[model samples]
Target chain A: EPEVTQTPSHQVTQMGQEVILRCVPISNHLYFYWYRQILGQKVEFLVSFYNNEISEKSEIFDDQFSVERPDGSNFTLKIRSTKLEDSAMYFCASSEEVGRNQPQHFGDGTRLSIL
Target chain B: GESVGLHLPTLSVQEGDNSIINCAYSNSASDYFIWYKQESGKGPQFIIDIRSNMDKRQGQRVTVLLNKTVKHLSLQIAATQPGDSAVYFCAENRLTGNQFYFGTGTSLTVIP
Candidate 1:
C-alpha cells in the first residue's frame, strides 16, 4: 500500500528560528494535510492543501505558519519563527480527493523539538 | 463508564480478550467518523471508519459502531493482542469539510 512519507523523522531547532518540514505525499493523492499532536493532547489540524493552495486551516495555524506544494509530489510546511510551544509530533496525510467521506492516509510523523 | 483525566485513559485487557474503546464526539453535523491507532511517538494509523448512514462497519479484526443520535462511536477489537496495545482515537469529519476533529485518545494495554 502506498503511504505518505515525511522527512527528518526528528527535528531540533532553537526558538525563534525558521523550520521547514517536508513531506512526499502519495503519487495519486489530490489532497495533502498537516496536523500536529502536542504531547498528551489530541491531534490538531494545521492546514489542508489542494491544487497548490490552502483549502482550510485551524486556529492553531497562525501567521507564523504556512504550507506550500513546492512540486507535484512534495508538500512543505514552514514556520517562520518557531516557539517552545511548537514542540510536537507533526504528521502529514494524503487523501485521494477532498470530501467529507474521503479517508486520509498518514505518515509516521516528524517530531519537532523547539528548544 | 468514562472519567476525565489529565492523562490518556488506560484500558487493560488480557491477550485474546475482546476490547471496546468508546468516544463521544462534539459535533452533531459530522457525517463521517474514523478510528485511528497511534503507537508511542508515531502518527495515527487508520483503523476503521463508519458513515452516519451506517450503524456498523467491520474491518479485519476491528468493528466500528456509530450512534449518530448520541454522537457516540466505538471501536471493538476482537481477540486483542499485544500488537494492539496503543492509543486509540476517534475522529469526526464535518458534514461539508475535510477538517477532522480528533477525540482524546484511550490507551489500550494488552497484557500478555
Candidate 2:
C-alpha cells in the first residue's frame, strides 16, 4: 500500500530559528494535511492544503506558520520562529479527495525538538 | 466547538479476550465517525469508520457501534492480541466540512 512519507524523522532546532518540515504525499492524493501531537496530548490539526492553497487552519497555525507546495510532489511547512511550545511530533496526512467518507492516511511523523 | 472524548483512559485485558472502548461525542451535526490506532512514536492509523445513517459497521476483528440517540460510540475488538496494544482515538466529522475532530484517546494494554 502506498503511504505518505516525511523527511527528517526527527528535527532539533534552536529557539528563534526557522524550521521547515517536508512531506511527500501519495502520488495520486489531492488533499494534504498537517497535524501535531504534544508529548502526551491529543493530536491537533494544523493546516490543510489543496490545489496549492490552504483550505483550513487551526488557531495553533498562526503567523509563524506557512505551508507551500513548492512542487508537484513536495509539501512543506515553514515556521518563521521556533518556540519551546512548538516541540512535538508533526505528522503529514493525505487523502485521495475531500469527501464525506474518504479516509486520510498518515506518515510515521517527524519529532520536532526545540532547544 | 464540540469535541469527541473517550470514557476510559486505560484498559488492560488478557490476550484472546474481547475488548470494548467507548466514546462520547457532543457534536449533533457530525455525520461521520472514524476510529484510529496509534503506537508509541507513530501517527494515527485508520482502523474503521461509521456513518451516522448506520447503527453499526464491522471490520476484520473490529466492530463499531453507533448510538445516535445518546451520541455514543463504541469499538469492540474480538480475540484481542498483544499487537493490539496501543492508543485508540475516535474522531468525528461535521457534515459541512472536511475537518475531523479527534478525541483524547484510550490506551489499551493486552496482557500476554
Q: Please name the candidate that would achieve the greatest lDDT relative to the true structure.
A: 2
Give the per-residue lDDT of model 2 (tens digit) for B5-108: 46458889899999988899879989999999999877889999999999999999999999999999889999999999999999888875677888889999
Quantify all predictions' global Cα lDDT against the true fold: 0.89, 0.89
Question: Model 1 segments beyond 4 Å from truth?
Answer: B1-8
> Which 10-residue span in candidate 2 chain B carries the lowest summed lDDT?
B1-10
How many residue pairs in model 2 have overlapping backbones? Answer: 0
Q: What is the TM-score of each candidate against the true structure?
A: 0.95, 0.95
* Model 1: DockQ vs. true structure: 0.78
Encode model 1's per-residue lDDT on A19-58: one tens digit a residue.
9999999999999999998888889999998888899998
After superposing candidate 2, which stretches have Cα over 4 Å from the reference? B1-7
